[model samples]
Target: MRQPGGDEDGTEPGDGEPGSRLAALGGLHLEEAPPDGGVPATGRSPRTARNRTLIVSALLAATLIACLGTAVHLFLRINEPSSAERPPPPPPPRPGASMSGPAGGGPRPVAQPVRTENDLDMVCADRFYPSAPRFRGSAPHPVMISEGEETGADFRSTRTLNRAAFAGSATQRRTWAPDPERAQIVACLDLTGPGRKIRDCRAGDGTLPLVEGRYRLAVYEVATRRRILQKDLTGTDRACPFVIRTGAGDTLHSAVKDQQLYDLLHQRVEG
Candidate 1:
């Protein structure tokens, strides 16, 4: 089955091509060149090419991300205000604002309260029973309750220096004004009217009377003339009004209650 001008494998020899002649002579096999204008062989493995492609793609992605971040940062900086907003300054104070106080911020003098026509000022000084009354055996200490005070003077619910009240029948146990010869303590509560007063009438002395009442509860020792205690009494309506409300007096007395003067003379017998 051999053709007349062909080899055993039916191949042509010396067909006017160098590759064909070399094949006809046998043994030498030359590699064919790739097609014209094709890519040249670099002899690199597929793994190497794949790795290079991955590196290039990563570089491109990084560059894109960096550019996007830069663009966002610039946009934020451009849209912001130049500086932060601030509050307006306060207005200046008016003239003579500090004239009520002392100059150069010294201690400001407290202004005394002005006495109005109807104002009742019955404030009195404070003193306490620092020492208990001493007793000799058991003779009742005689005390004189204040009487014939100024018309408008009275005692009410205790205030300021007051610690008790002098209610009506609940407190009037004994005589109002006892004789000074029989009494050992004179609970004298004198008064001076807010209105104008004249001199002494019985003897006709020309000296002016007091303006305001000295609202006090002064307990005096009869023979010794030593002051036991003097407390400021609370007044009613105007200063030191005798009658206001009815009860067991306004407050509790430290030493005596009920008939405060009588209770003081009778109960406070411990020395």
Candidate 2:
């Protein structure tokens, strides 16, 4: 089997075959066989992959635990009541008792009386007319006639006076009179028939006289009514001058002669 220029042992020239010579020149060596299922084709060990998986799983478990703890904390915070959501405290008990009732057993504190302007007006009205029966003598003193021209004999002769006299009921005359505390008397007169006699009654007697023609006196309160003096002479001559005492021990005199009262009444009635 020896070819031409070949050795007798089937060996090529130059110490080995051409492939072996190339292998030796390239420094190649025989590789050992790998054990079954020991290492993958990717050259990574099975134990290394398992370790990486374990580390990833441990990290995921830690993240899940942290998220669960945060959710629980948030749930508790949302469910708990804040200070602003809490109920208010109860009010303190009254001094007299723990519960309201009759005196001593569970006494209720007495409420103090409150006086209003309406109450004061009511009181002033009541002072002029009382609930109890009063005789003509016991009633408010009549206006006195000191100095005035006595023209007519009786006040009923005047058409105006006659109409006013019969206008009210007997019951109203008994209990009703102008409130003198707050009202101001604008005019006082003693009249006779067709002849009109105007007199300055302020200098005269305190009592307003009702005699002769139409005896009419205007009494008014500017605060309650817009005009103090009536627009027409339609009422009886029963108004008189009165004195009111103030809390400061001063006496306030209200009469027809007051310049302020005369001006205000004249402005309203005349204008």
Candidate 3:
């Protein structure tokens, strides 16, 4: 072979080029091989591996610490008392128990008794009638009568009398016949003892002599002692009279009727 520079052998300008197949074939070029066996790795090296090992070890230690902390917290919570299951205790009371001071106190004051209507009626009776024997006599004409139930509101004790009984005496004495006027008077004073006193004893007309004093009353009148029977006794003949006796033996009679007796009686009994 001939050389271009007039050398004895044929040789190129790049004689030491690396990875040259021509240089390996000894065609007058020198080539060099790489110092490393192959190409570099795409990722980490041994030092990186050591760093990774320490990083993994640190992460594992952190996980263990976190788990231990969680376990300790759960252990403490399980041992503690639960407010949901327990009930609150009741409050304590004082030693002595009472409404006024403390417990075991004294009694309080009570109210007084009030007077009723019944009490007032009994009082009226006792005040008016104190003597037992003061309402009885003869004509003054006295007729005996018995107690009867006070049915009417006005007149506690009353009965109708025959008008004809006073016909003979009517001409001589100014007398009222058995009418509303006479019945009215009996109604007023009989129960209260006003009817017992007859002052001016004309045959049929008269006034009662009621002195201011306490008197007692008997429930009965005795006409047997008078021996005064109804003579004509016909056509409502004879004196239609009412008689009442006191507890002390005095008797009351009235031929003239008054309304006051009945009114007072009515108020006391039914009302």
> Estimated TM-score per prediction?
0.24, 0.20, 0.19
Quick one: best TM-score, which candidate? 1
Stretches > 4 Å off in candidate 1: 1-139, 147-180, 192-214, 237-271
Which stretches of candidate 3 lie above 4 Å from their native place?
1-39, 84-271
Error of 3 at 213 (Å): 60
Model 3, span 181-223: residue lDDT tens: 1111111112223322324323235443432222122221111
Candidate 1 all-Cα RMSD = 24.2
Q: lDDT of all the models against the reference?
A: 0.39, 0.33, 0.30
Colliding residue pairs in candidate 2: 143-207, 143-208, 144-207, 146-205, 152-192, 154-212, 191-213, 192-213
Return the TM-score for candidate 3, rounded to 2 decimals: 0.19
Put down candidate 1 lDDT per residue, 40-63, tens digits, no spaces: 353455678999999999999999
Is candidate 1 or 3 superior in lDDT?
A: 1
By lDDT, who's the top model here? 1
The TM-score, computed over Cα atoms with residue i paired to residue i, of candidate 1 is: 0.24
Tell me the number of clashing residue pairs for each predicted model: 7, 8, 40
Question: Model 2, 203: alpha-carbon shift in Å?
Answer: 48
Total clashing pairs in model 3: 40
Taking every candidate in turn, the Cα RMSD to the unseen true structure, in Å, is 24.2, 25.0, 33.2
- Model 1: number of backbone collisions: 7
Expressed as tens digits, the lDDT of each residue in 87-129 for candidate 2 is: 8788675342211111343212223221222221221111112
